[model samples]
Target chain A: MAEAEGEMSSLLEEAAARRAAPGRALVRDAGLIVGAALDMAARFRRDGRLLAFGAGASAADAGHLAVEFTHPVIVGKRALPAISLANDASAVSGIAVSRGYGAVFSTQLRMLGRPEDIAVGFAVEDRCGDVLGAFAAARQLGMLTIALVDGALMDRTLVDGTLVDHVLDARSGDPRIAGEAHMTTYHLLWELVHVFLDDPAPLDGPGTAASGCAADATCVTCADTAVPVHVTELRPGGLALVDTGGGTEEVSVALIEARVGDTVLVHAGEAIAVLGGDAP
Target chain B: MTGALYPFAAAGGDTTREELVMSTAAKAAESVELRLRVLERLGPSLAACARAMATAFRAGGTLLAFGNGGSSTDAQSVAQLFLTPGRGGRRLPAISLTGDSALLTALANDVHFDVVFARQLTALGRRGDIALALSTSGGSANVLRGLEAARRAGLVTVGFAGSGGGRMAAERLADHLFVVPSSSVHRIQEAQATLCHVLWELVHQALAGAEAGGVQAGGEEASDGGLGAGGVGADGVGAGGA
Candidate 1:
């Protein structure tokens, strides 16, 4: 087992070494293209919508990227223009069966994608009919295109004259790490796109992060959210109360407390908790 | 030993309480492991399929789910999860192919069990609709038939199956086949419940633009509580606390 572990470590080192190469050349090139993508995203903010597509690992990446744009973590941030192509199963299957799997995303791009919209194509393997067709259709529609291709399969011609404005070969490491790396690449890109949207001063400041809301947490009742009521009657599950907000509207069987004038979050049909108290 | 152990006696030895408990635990762990591995490996594909379902519903398309036995129950549970609101937002248009006894019995007895799901798909499915089928073995004839019919009807097919994906994994009928590897029915069913719950939650997460699916406002969002007069009567399809 020790010998096996030693051999595995050596192989990982070699793969890592290969990735960190290009003598600053590739870094400069990637920076330029990433800059271009940021600009295109700014253009999308103006008049275009960005549509992302992929299958398998690619699909997850597309969804993750779309979520970042659609659901910005920043509290007051408005959503940017974006949609994930992989999210529509009907379109994919319809195109796959009728026109072939290759035309699945391509058909949708042709129909719904406007000239101002951008198409971001992610391909895990070299020969993907769906990816190719989507790229072609997006180009024909005169929309900006970006290809996040994996490893050494970087055939520059795939993007040549077509509307593919940027190609970032994320030269991701070995088979196991490749998919995850692609995900990380896009996650980073999603954040960078946000940088293009917000002002520069806030960019220097710490970026906003997601709140850690668990699956089981209920909405905590506080004075700000719930309307106060006076307990008029008590029922089996909880309480009945008269609304303090206005004319004698009655609320029945909510929360554990039936004490008159006590506020509670009316959860479900029944009130489940007391205001400013730990949720039951 | 229980009566169920008699079948196993023919191939091996008598079943013991210790063995049954240990095996059940092992099977549960194995099933959970396999499910996590598949999700980790096929994250993008599954996420993509889920996203498509979300988009289809958002664009006025409906989601339909089906299966046999335990899978049938799972289908109903998932449909109910979506059709009802737990915390946030209103109910989306989702239907379980197994919910209506009249339709199921009619399709099962008149045509054949194999055509039960297929015929339903034929009648209801349209372009941009999503058809989700669940089977632990992934080899249910009725499920496969339904998948074929869904494909013919231009609906996206997603299958959740187990044990090396069986026929559904190989037939290419499922655009996405999430295979839970363990063979134990109990473990697979438990994990299937978890998987569907996650998908249902994701649908809500995507819809509400919330990070997690939390309990929000319940019924009384509107006069009819988001359900139309004739559509989805006051069983309060979208009413549930947490």
Candidate 2:
């Protein structure tokens, strides 16, 4: 009661701070993330689907990311296959009751996922032990495993591990921040994967992504990015000379503000929006 | 390829000096505006929503929440935040309708998909309870049906919506509605988070005041306690509660 006077401001600040942790992390790992997404796009071209799962707060993340893929909010964007394993309440309880809480995610994957499909798991601390189990199951099936880990315990196992192909770390311990960061990371991944898929050169003309890794569907590659860069300057006619990881790329920022140094959301050939803001 | 990949045009890393400064500065601007807008225009509605929540909790009512996609996650977040509040706040009963996969899939499969939430409501809602619906577009069919169902079951309804509140505002749904006027979904969600947090705080604060004897109470039950007499059955899960 006595603390009510400043409670509003304090709470608002905490929310922003929580959002900031993941926001910054996603930006720093932009290149690595975009590369991982490019690999994911290639997988999708081979008719691979995405299966997302988590527990507690991260379960919501699984659902949110799944919906974004299954039903693209952006117009004309193709709907990719994605499923949230946590969407079915009865299946969850039955599995948790029969097997254990740690069995829900992996059990669903064992039933539904194929070797070509991708598994996205989110774990904050040790709260959701099944994320690891899901990864283990996905690995056994030779599916690509992408994990978003918040705490050191989960990170220690998932990062640089063979079981998970992609491990994105949020860098902060706040559970809320981890959840928020996971949202942005997935959103960014969704956008970039679309960008690569829309390009269609690799899938349409030559042997599809099903060729090299078709047997195991696990050979992934990450080139030094050609478009992942910061706009150095906005020239006339919606063009930007951006500093890429290795060199520079002249890109169109017609959709978003042609601002200098913004992390342009380059989808297909157009800069859809500046990262962290909605499409303009 | 969709045109040639944008050729790299700048030399050296943009990271050394300019990118970090400008990106951080520009990106944070919209969020700051979002915070300011919520802080300035959202206080009154948040107060009302909190008061409603406090009244419902006092009457031993449960808060039932529903939404779709990101809003669904937010709905669950709201429930989690309320049910297991950090600090020294009292634990309140709240349910995210989307959390139960079996019940949700069962309803969606058995009945019409749009009626999933509404069906849950019909089974569980009581007169003294509250239904909080979150939809960024504010026009999600399932959410609308759920609101109607809650109203029919004598529950108070509040909604978190975006961009002119969509049909929720147009159709005059929600006894209490807080609309994030922004068109950007990210900003809208951020603003909604602010409002939800503020509402949680305001309700906790009010409860603390009443519990501390700072506010005099009317000894008798607040009349119009809204059908609390014929509430949920002995199990409190209603007859058909799945």
Candidate 3:
């Protein structure tokens, strides 16, 4: 019993010490990136968009970040003019097999990217032809580029000609952070960029963005015309009911149904159900 | 209050050792306390990471999660927290690297284990993607290889590991390493899961706040776009290769 008590005490102390490690360094770097992101937003106001691409975990990051821009929880947000190059299956496969992986991002950038746009690459390091190609395209297009990399790969000169404006390096090699850290980095970036775009303070005057044409306090999706939508509660396998108010018309009930009070995305008067809820 | 509310108290409940009440209560308290401690230590780093993701997201990027075995489940958990909201709002875009069996099996069968993640990285990765990898030991060959791929691809590399940081800690593959400081897999996993959940909450709060204020993260509204069934607010089409 005494030994157990001592062990417990030691554990508690260790946990406390671990908890106290300062995060100011990480936060500061994050701040710089956020500032850069805000600049990107300002450029976007001039009709520019942000483009992201990656493979595997990196690919997942590209897709995940793209989603946050497209859909938000807060009421009255607008869809950002950004795209994830990794979200298209045919495009990626066709490019990968025909042109090789290096051209994947560059190919997309050539057709869609503009000088006002911002291009970002998420990698543990700053090598590889695909990453280089994308960066080169961004540079050639006179677009701003940023790289998120690990400390081991922090030498910005490797990319040449200031291709990367900011580098957030963790200086650690834990594989989990390969995913976990991203959740942290991008989440912060998303918030900081929003702050610049919205100027949350009502005292800051009007925001630059326009409002959507939805009926609810939280509706962010808008169309030129008000499409009628009928929402109904859906039950799948007699498990539970889901509300489909924010649902789009093409929402597939093959997995569930549309329901009232459910937040949904509507396009052309069809119920395109969002994931989560009752859909299997 | 119900009239019968005090029945148990009025009966002077017999708290006996045979009931295992004492040990159970003690254990629960200890668990809660340990969790609290872990959170306290990791709060700032975790919060900062979330903030970073929010920023990247507003700028248009992707979030990718990967892990092995139960840790793979952790990756899935991370993906779900963003892609699907348990309550309030809609989904966000996120993916678990372990979600597809065909991809995993094929990679393992056709290529070396070290290339599992790297190959995917080469095939799908580009600039501005976030590569998130999880490994309790921080020494999984595939995970290490994946992180290398992420780095080479210019993806933001992040990791979650245990012990004195293992190879993940010493090698610098991750831009951020959150170590559990313990060799016990159970304890490390528990803490990591908790960290992921907290991150989910933070991301939601930040994004929801931004959207409510009528601001766009990626220059778009926060509501209608998403990619997966997990509820990430993705737009047009589904997750592609890798």
Candidate 4:
């Protein structure tokens, strides 16, 4: 009896100790997390939908986050638009079967993502190819990309500013601990986003970039207008340089097949469709 | 276009950026503190439950998990953790009852939403198997029905609930019930996830000890010997009709 009691205490102590570091780390990164929440609120104000995806256990996190946003539990909390790419098993499986597993999330993002949308990807480890692919597709769509990843990803540069705009690290070697920390971080995100949204003060006051809108003209991204532009050069990572009549600008051509000299409809810094005729 | 359209400057407000950051930090700290307290309070019961689960697993029993909303996703995660533990942890047989949307919707549409999990448990549960239910509110109709079904089917019923275990505890539906003493749904869920993780680890520990001790078969005997004689008897572990 004594031995069993000792074993239970030891197990409990170990479990408690394992989770401490990750929780402390989350508290330490509160500033960054709040900043990300502010940005998310800005996107939401622009009527941007949140698209979240992940693989394995992280898939559950994606669904959990989506449901929280789309169906607010607390009374008086407004429901923000959100969807989990991992929720539809048929779509995920079909995409995997036709284009391979790595293309599942990217394909969905290409079809569903908009310029003002927010993309949040979760991964217990940094090595999930599907998550990285989805981030690439999100960036190409001019969506604000956020990554919730394990501590090992903190040292990696693969998900740098080029792909993910905000990276929240769980900072735990153990997957279970990291997963718990991620839940806390995202819960904080959901709460803070509401806080910012409910606050009367404008998120982007006088000096800041105009609501952090990627487009330069009329905020057409939120306006749901697509303008025709001529592609001048194709850049790496699915980016294309386009001539918008006023000046040259860079846009994402990931959704459609676009080549240099091709006229494409650019909306929210992304080429939505390729026009067959000459640039207007 | 104009500054009027894009008003997101750091202007004067009752709540500044620093205050928001501080609020977030405080929430995180509160979550951490709640988790620690819950673990400290429920550690013994969790350990006992893990031993029971290990025994069931050794006897070729499968784990069936169910819940609602956020708890539903958490149930799926718990199943995934056991089915594909990774990191050299042994794979276990498990299924999330919430995985099949079609069946769930059908059951809810045809009969009622409250019986979604209950109907699945009635069909799948067997003697000595494990039924793990999660509910942040502790009063989810579907979760309560699922536990009742598991108990009827002679399965080892375990529940993770918040706000004092509600109907599950009141009715004594679960042989083992771990409740997070929090009113906030988010904090309850975050702590529940940690609870599941700790339970998973403890089960693995018990299984490893069993393997090392060379007690392969006879699940009840192995559990009794491994846990120490009379330490956690059949009644204490609720060995499902033993």
Candidate 5:
């Protein structure tokens, strides 16, 4: 019994360790994730809805992502329009039967996707043909495309600004670990998108224009913008001292009711909303 | 070129990009911490549950999984994981009650949404089978109903819940309950996924132990070490030394 218990403990530890590396890898792509949220917010500002799809377990992820956006779990957060292409089994089966299985997501994308919408695809390991196809279709429709894929499967072509605007890799070969990392990735995406949307900053800033993806200059959109600041002290005159990653900055909090010890989304010296707080 | 690509660098004084990086890092750290905590807390219970599950599977029992919303999708993933696991893993008999959209909608529209899973359990569940339900809140009406039905039918009930197990913990609705001690729904679901995966691995391990010990059907005299002494045979067919 002692030996058995030891083995079980070791197994549990191994499982926990295996899931950690992929999650850590996501921290390296914070800039990319934040950028994606900015562009997703831009698309939503244009009355665009999010269309998410994937295969097998990833299909479930697609549903989870869609629900997170369409139904805000946190009170006071606005519900954004979103839909999961994998939710309707009847439609998926019909598309697979009529137009090969690889056409499932692509077919749905072509039918429902719009120029202003956002398309997020989930692909575990190398089983990403349908997701790749959907990205291709999304590109043709001028949609903002993002992909969450396994690190082993990400290659030059997928990240070369051709297929996906944002390619976040969950750096793990194990599909389960990759799925967990993907969950965290999308949660960040959901949270940061709200942060950007709440901010009144112009999406096409000087940095955006320099990236060669200005709204009027070109149709291309880049994902690398904005960050949240930690509020250290709330001043009396609608101002707060915020930790801006490097140093403290006194920013106007007139737009938001921010408290000390809260993370606030800042844009051009103004605090928009308190990050990860209850709606008050 | 560097400033252009990195908006934070181009924004002059705003160095909050580092904070953005830190935020992601913080969430990742939180996730790892929660997972480790769950493993440390539930390791023994997980092992015992896996043993029971292996015994039920050996006796030709299928796994019936159900949940709501994201948990509903997770239920489908659980079924899929068992039915088609990773390389070198054996295919197990499992079904997600949330797979059939038409049936689920019909049940919800015709009857109350609370009875969708319970009605399915009545039709598909049997004694000695396993019922796995996932709920972030642990107070979902339909999930409680499903557990009640599973208990009535003699199926081994397992529940994955969060936020102090909600009412499921209070009422003891599950034979083996794993509650992720968090109020964040996203974190709870992530930890639940890890728990499910670990349980799957342990079940495989238990099954392997059974195989190595030559514990086959119709051999009441055979003793496959202490692994077969879990006393999970409510049906009386697969009990050890029956």
Candidate 6:
């Protein structure tokens, strides 16, 4: 009895340690997930849906992630279309038993995915054969491939273009930690994608160069109605007084060194970047 | 170069690569430390949960588990663990209310989602049955409703929730509540899994007689020794998977 008690304590601590190990992995690798989310959001704008797949315990993640996107438990958030390839366990097993386990998810993707859709697959072991098949199938369909993997093949993912474009690796040997890391990665993707959707013409807009600060945000030409501006006064730090076709306004000049009478690009009371010379 | 929330190197072009490497290393060390602390704190409560669950199971009660989202998976896992009991333990009768897609969809579509689990419990639950629910937030309306239904039906209600126990604690819904006092959802889920394993083992120990004997139930795919691995689990969509 005493021995059982001691072992239980030890087991709890061990499980906690295993579970806790993913936070570091999330912090280090979550940026790559964010970058992928940005791309996926662009795909979303094109009316693309998300298709997710995984095997074993990870199968549950596929369902959880799908419901999160489709139903959106949070109030006021719009639902995004998502489907879990593993939702129908009968079909999955039927395929596995009849055709092969590898064909289960791939067959689903071939039937459901489109060229503009996004395919996200996850795995816990060094390789989830079914997930690998799904990614390959999705890539062939011209879908964007995102993999949340924490297995031994993680190092090879960066080198393998055919396997995945955006790979967020938990870098853990434990499945529990990998599962936790995958959740964090997907949550970050959901959040960062929302950040992109919150804008009509975000950083990728025509007039915006995606400069470091908002002071350098170029909405002048992008906004479609800003008038041409001529620099009337030039101060240090790229600050400029410009005369819009309408009136004089002050704008920041971080992108360009504006001189008096120089044609400066200004947007909503800010100078985006300076034109090389005065407007014709 | 220092960081605000984390100890990170100053962002610079030349040192960025080296700094990122250092930052990951430092962050890993810190995370392991925090995980260990969280684990240490959960030991006692996990023990309590095991003792309680063992008593309930030994008394011939069934475990009816439920949850939402990722937590629903946890509830299913809990049921699977009890139903199989792996190697050393006698298989106990447990059902995950979330496992039935037909029932889940019907309840969700026909009436309302809040009553999905509660309605099922009303029909299926009996006195001396055990109800186990998993919710990271502890505030999931459905889980709360299910727990209330389980308790009213004479079932012993237990909950696995994240830090602060959310509304589960606020309303005292669970008879034996296991709270993973972590704000991070990942950590909380992981801790919850660990707690379940501990509690499951204890329940088995309580039930495993000399005739039952010890069986290896570690990591290896230890299928049935004498019981046979028939219908290993309810794989959500159907009866079993290949």
Cα RMSD to the true fold for all candidates? 24.1, 14.8, 21.8, 11.5, 15.2, 12.5
Where's the lowest-lDDT run of ten residues in candidate 3 chain B? B228-237
Best by lDDT: 4
Pairing residues by index, what is the TM-score of model 4? 0.80
Candidate 4 on B29-78: residue-level lDDT in tens? 98999899889998988989999999999998999999988888999999
User: Model 6, residue B219: displacement in angstroms?
Assistant: 16
Model 2, span B117-193: residue lDDT tens: 99999999999899999888888999999999999898889988999899988997899988988786766775676
Worst 10 residues of 6 chain B by lDDT: B229-238
Q: Model 1, B72-133: lDDT tens per residue?
A: 64576566556653333357677889757788789878878899899999999997788999
Instruction: Compute DockQ for each candidate against the true complex.
Output: 0.02, 0.10, 0.03, 0.22, 0.18, 0.13
lDDT of all predictions: 0.56, 0.66, 0.55, 0.78, 0.76, 0.65
Better of 1 and 2 by lDDT: 2
Off by over 4 Å in 1: A1-280, B1-28, B208-242
lDDT of model 3 at residue A156?
Answer: 49
User: Model 5 chain B: which ten-residue window has the lowest total lDDT?
Assistant: B226-235
- Runs of candidate 2 with Cα error greater than 4 angstroms are A1-6, A151-155, A159-163, A200-280, B1-44, B84-90, B99-123, B148-154, B185-242
Q: Per-residue lDDT of A1-280 in model 4, one digit per residue for the tens?
A: 4665577689899889887878888999998787678778867866788999988788899999998998888766788999999979899899777876767787788888887789998866543547776776777666788888887664354344445778888888677888888898888888778877877353432212222343244443223357888988986546677787767776667678998889998754557798875454
Q: Which residue pairs come into collision in candidate 5?
A: A35-A223, A35-A224
Chain A (alone) TM-scores for all candidate structures: 0.60, 0.69, 0.59, 0.72, 0.72, 0.68
Write candidate 5's Cα lDDT for A113-188 as tens digits. 8766889998776655477777777766667788888766754556555557777888887888888788888888
The DockQ-derived docking category for candidate 6 is incorrect
Q: Give the backbone clash total of model 1.
A: 12
Q: lDDT by residue for model 3 over A1-280, one digit each (tens)? A: 3543343344344434432221223433443444455545555554567788755445656765666566642345566766778657788879767876667777788788776677776654332336656666665655667666544454445333344555555443432243444444554555445544554221122111111112233332223233334445442211122233454322222223444444433432223454333332
Per-residue lDDT over A1-280 for candidate 6, one digit per residue giving the tens place of the 0 to 100 score: 6766676666665666555546655666644554576667756765779998876556767777787678755455678999988768698888778766657787788788876688988866543556766766776666778887775554364324435667777777665566656765665566456555654233343322111122244434324344558888875434566676655555555556677877866653345566757665
Q: Higher-lDDT candidate among 1 and 3?
A: 1
In Å, residue B38's CA in model 2 sits off its true spot by 3.7
Candidate 3 Cα errors over 4 Å, as ranges: A1-22, A125-129, A158-161, A200-280, B1-242
